[model samples]
Target: MRRVADHLDIPELERRFRTCPDAVEARHVQVIWLLAQGHTVGATSEVTAFGTRWIEQLLERYNASGPDALANGRRRNGLKPSLLTAEVLEVVRLRLADPPPDGGLWSSRKVADVIAAHLGLERVLPQRGWEALKALGWSLQRPRPRNPKSATAEEAQAFKKLADAVAEEAAAHPGVAVEVFCTDEHRLGLKPVLRSVWAPKGQRPTALGHHRFLWLYVTAFVGPATGETVWYLTDTVSKPLFADLLDAFAKAIGAGPDKRVVLLLDNAGWHTLPNLVVPAGLRLVYLPPYSPELQPAETLWTLVDEPIVNTFVPNLDRLINTITERCTNLTTRQPEISSRTNFAWWPANRVPS
Candidate 1:
């Protein structure tokens, strides 16, 4: 048993342990506090969940420097010299701009090989390669899938045009409360939607699934600027149904000569203007073909599916009820919705006339 010096009395040590703001410092204080109470080093290790060797080192520091030494020392020590030099990092950055030699995605091993080749070494550790990537502020990310038919230049031009059109509408009806909204439909069914979740190292979590073709459609109208959403649940989607939804939505938002609305949506078959009954003061703007990514309402589907993902629904009614509840809750979370859907290029609310 190593004696804890009388630098801090037991009650003072207890107070420091309790009031310490830093978690690591609090833990170190706890070890010293326990030892001051006559607990052996092995006993203090068991209590703090710290190794005995670590407790011994901590005791040495505390006895020598008093309570001030309990703070985490690792943070004060600056980072060690990186293996990735400036020249090497530039080479890695340039190489990353193109596909790897194998015409596949770049990996740590490939980056290590690149580094090794540059340094004229036989090989470099993959761990060092990973560190190099971090030093360059690169992260592993799943790429967003894009439709090959979608034209980037066309999307940019279309967005600019839409912004202009919205501005024009606001200008035409000045001070009439013109609101920009994006609407989309999502299909949910009895089929399970599986997603990865954290579990213990060797244990895998399971979700019960019963795949069925029975479906329900959730139509959402979301304002990108304010995140105000109007949701309608229906069993089917058609021109007539969509028209009715438009009428209901118009009534809900009080869209008319007093308040104009510019609604953006995709070029779906049911969303066409022909034979479609668009309500008064509601102008429909179609997004460029094959560009669902441009639709703000498209971002709401993930939020709408949270309740039912990786879980089994016995029937359509249960699924509908679950989704309905989720949608109702989402209506209150405007800030979250706005943050997710408000793309930088999307026009701001209340555009100057």
Candidate 2:
């Protein structure tokens, strides 16, 4: 095998190995060149970290067809040739999105077999199925489990127009500095169970889900333009409690005789109660009933849950302490909240000075 490289000696082969663009091919060239330099195949295998049999095959190919045989074959960039073309790949992507026709999931073998048949080829490796799907821009994703409903086209259009109009009015108004704030409420219990996390290879994580998993309500008002936020946590979430939170939020936003807040809220039962207290300089605006899709503050719940997500707190006091700490931290993260909640139809990113 070493003598077969008589024409292309170790010096020239070493130059070719250095000049080769691809690392894998360069390795193949180096293996044959080393054998030419009087190194045994086993030593070459140990040095190259490639198996002995693969080294032998490299030598055999070089002996049969010279240096060109050591280069990449029909496989392009380590990918198989079966699913290489675009026309065959599009069909595979379409089929891959749906389950197998016989009422089960699509396995790599099934996909590879189908694609091979489509291309009029004998067979394709199961691993190539993954490459084909990836080439078509598909990914292994776990979509939101509950398939929540979205606003209808008409509803979405109407909301966009109305929101745009409100923004325009706020921008054009004279003297009075009006700011839009999206408000929402979330209930957290004393359960520390999360859906998933990074854990040791095959262990299901455990968390403290104490018997008292009752509700602890958190009400928040977020000024998307100015990155201003106010939150209140309590055991009760009625109109009266909402009133107290609104009063505190009023002071947090520097609500005075001149400056005002245009607050947006969902149509919850407590929110619509008669004589519900809306603080001075803060006007409450109700979004359409059952339409949470329009409210920006709903997005803040995922962020506020970060601190206490996978922990075991003893009682309501500890839970409240953790929740309060997270709330205080969130006030400083107004920019993130704004970016997450502020929609394209919402007002400009400016708060009254």
CA lDDT of every candidate:
0.88, 0.77
lDDT tens per residue, model 2, 1-353: 34555659778999998999988889999898889888998899988998999998989889888988988664465655644687788788777777787778776678788788897889988877777767777677876432235556576567654355456646665466667787899988876646567899879788766656577888888877767788888898788878888888888877656666677887788887578977887767777556776788888888888777777777788778888999999989877877887788776533454
- For model 1, residues 1-353, the per-residue Cα lDDT tens digits are 67899998999999998998888999999999998888999898888999999999999999999888889876655564356899999999898898989998889999999999999999999977887788889999998888787758655565665687688888888877778888999998998898887889999888999888998999999888888899999999999999999999999988898888889988889999789999998999888878887788888888898898788789988988899999999999999999998888877766333
- What's each prediction's TM-score? 0.70, 0.70
Model 1 stretches astray by more than 4 angstroms: 1-83, 196-203, 343-353
Superposed Cα deviation of residue 259, candidate 1 (Å) = 1.1
Stretches of candidate 2 exceeding 4 Å from the true structure? 1-82, 94-99, 145-149, 153-158, 165-173, 193-206, 251-257, 273-280, 286-294, 333-340, 343-345, 349-353
lDDT of 2: 0.77
